[model samples]
Target: MAGIKENWVTGVGFGNFQKAYQIYEKEEMIFRAYVNHAHNEYLELAFEGGVIAAILMALYLFLLLIAFTKIRRDALQKTAFLSVVFLLVHSLADYPLRTAALAMTFAYMNAIIFHRGFAECRNQSPELVEVDHNGDKLFVPVGASP
Candidate 1:
C-alpha cells in the first residue's frame, strides 16, 4: 500500500519492483529475504505500473470475457476459458503471469478466444446473409446486406 501511495501514477518503473519493495518494506515486516512482488497480480500491476495500467488490465479482461462469450462452444474453448479462470483466481494469491511460460499460455488462450474465425454467430438464420467488405466478412440481415 505504501508503494502504491508513493508511486501510483507512473510506478517505480518496470523490473524495479524488488528495489522498490525493499524501500517500501515496513520495519515490523522485516524478513530475511527480499520481497520481489506484491503477491497479488492486480496489486503488483498497480504498484508497478500505476492506476492506468490497472485499468487497462481490467479492460483487457473484460474484453476477453466478451470475446469468450462470442466464440463457438467447443472443448478447446471451454478448456481455454477454464484455464483463464483458474489463472485469474490464482492471481489473487500469486503472480503467475510473471512467468514467461504462463504468460505465453495466457496469450495463446486469448488468441483462441478472440479469433473471429473461431466464433459461431448465435444469430445465424435464413433472414441473415454473409457479406464481405474489405476482406472482412460479417452476417447482416438480408435487407441490410450489401
Candidate 2:
C-alpha cells in the first residue's frame, strides 16, 4: 500500500518491484524474508506500473467477460471461459500471469476464444463413423474411423 501510495501515477517502473518493496518494508517486518510481489496480481500490477496499468487490466478482463458471454454455448468456448475464471480466481492469491507458461496458456486460451474460425466450426457437426466389433456397434468421429 505504501508503494502504491507513493507511485500511484506511473509506478516504480516494471521489474523494479523488489527495489520499491525494500523501501516500503516496515522496520519490524524487515526480519521476514523479502518478497518481490504483492501476492495479489492486481495490486502487483498497480505497484509495478501504476494506476493506469491496473485500469487497463480491468478493461481487458471486462472485455473477456463480454466475449465469454457471447460464445458460452460452445463447449470449447466454455472451457476457455473456465480457464479464464480459474486465472482470475487464482490471481487473488498468486501472480499466475507472471509465470511465462501460465501467461502463454492464458494467451492461447484467449486466442482460441477469439479465433474467427471457431464460430464456423461450432456450427458444423463433426462427421461420424459407425464401428462394429464383438457384435457391438459404436460411433466415433470420422477422424478416428477405422
Candidate 3:
C-alpha cells in the first residue's frame, strides 16, 4: 500500500497514453466521440483536491438545484439551468472547475443564481406611489397608463 501511494505520488504508475489515443484511417473514429470516451484521465482534480472535491461538488449540485427551482427571472433561470447541466456533464470527463477561468465562471453563475433568488424572495412586492409636480401623492391603477 505504501509503495502504491509512493508510486502515485511520483506519477510512476501512470504513463503517457499516446498509443491509446492513436487514430486509424480505417477505424474512422470521430473527434467528438473519441473525446467523450468513458475512460479518460478523470482523477487529476479528485486526487489533487481529495475529499474536498467531492464535498464541494455535492454542495454545488445542491445549490444548482435550488437556483434552478427558486430563481424568479425566466431568462436567468434558464441560463442557470443550462450552465449547471453543461458543467455537470463536462465534469464527467474533465475537471473544468479546476481551471481558474472555468472556476471563476462557475462561481459567477452560482452568485447570479443565489443572489437573484434571495433578492427576489426578499423583495417580493413593495408599496409605491406616484408624485405630481405639486407634491401630491397619486394612486394609479396597476395596469393603467400614467
Candidate 4:
C-alpha cells in the first residue's frame, strides 16, 4: 500500500513537471523541470492510448455538442457547457480524467447533461400536425394548429 501511494504521488509530481517543461522548452532546454523531451505525460499517453483516446475524445465532443443544442433549461445548459470547458482546459495541463476522484466528477456532469437533454426531447409534444383549409398538410405549434 505504501509503495502504491508513493508511486501515485511521484507520478502526479512528474506529470506537473512535464507541464512546466513544455512551457520552458519554448525558451530554454536545460530548465530544472525539463525531464528530457520524452516525459510529457499527456502526449506520451496519447501516443500509447492511440485509437482509444481518439474515440473517447470524439464521444466527449459529441456529448458537448448535443448538450449545448438540446438542453431545455438555460441554467443546466450553461452549467454543462462550463463543465465541459473546465474539463478541456484542465486536461491541457493535467490528467484529470486519469484520476479517480476527478474522473467521477466529470462523469456526473456528463450524465446530468445527457439526462436533461433526453428528458427535454421526450417531453416535447409530437402533436404538431395540422390540416389546412384546402386539406393541405401543415406543421404548427400544438395549440395553433387548426
| Backbone clash tally (model 3) | 0
Question: What would the per-residue lDDT of candidate 3 be over residues 1-146, giving only the tens digit for each residue?
Answer: 22223333432222322222332113555554443222322443333334555466578778778767766646675686688578767877765765688778877776666675455545565455575747877854343222
Off by over 4 Å in 2: 120-146
Task: Point out where model 3 deviates above 4 Å.
Answer: 1-42, 116-123, 130-137, 140-146
lDDT agreement with native, every candidate = 0.80, 0.84, 0.53, 0.57
Rank the models by lDDT, top first.
Answer: 2, 1, 4, 3
Pairs clashing in candidate 4?
Answer: none
RMSD of each: 8.8, 6.4, 8.6, 10.9
* Winning model by lDDT: 2
User: Over the stretch 34-132, how does candidate 2's per-residue lDDT look in tens digits?
Assistant: 787778988888998998998899898888877876784578877977897899899999999999999999988888777767677656677878889
Runs of candidate 4 with Cα error greater than 4 angstroms are: 1-45, 116-118, 121-146
Q: Which digits, one per residue and each the tens of the lDDT, describe model 4 over residues 1-146?
A: 22223333223232354453354345545656545324333453444344454466678788688767766556765686688679767777666677688788788877777675456555676667665867877776664312
Query: Could you tell me how far off, in angstroms, the CA of residue 101 lies in candidate 3 after the best superposition?
Result: 3.2
Show where candidate 1 strays beyond 4 Å: 120-146
Which candidate leads the pack in TM-score?
2
In angstroms, the error of model 3 at 45 is 3.3
Instruction: State in Å the error of residue 107, model 3.
Output: 1.8
The worst-scoring run of ten residues by lDDT in candidate 4 lies at 1-10
Summing lDDT over every window of 10 consecutive residues in candidate 2, give the lowest-scoring window: 137-146
TM-score quality measure for candidate 1: 0.76
Lowest-lDDT window of 10 residues in candidate 3? 16-25
**1 or 2, which is superior by TM-score?**
2
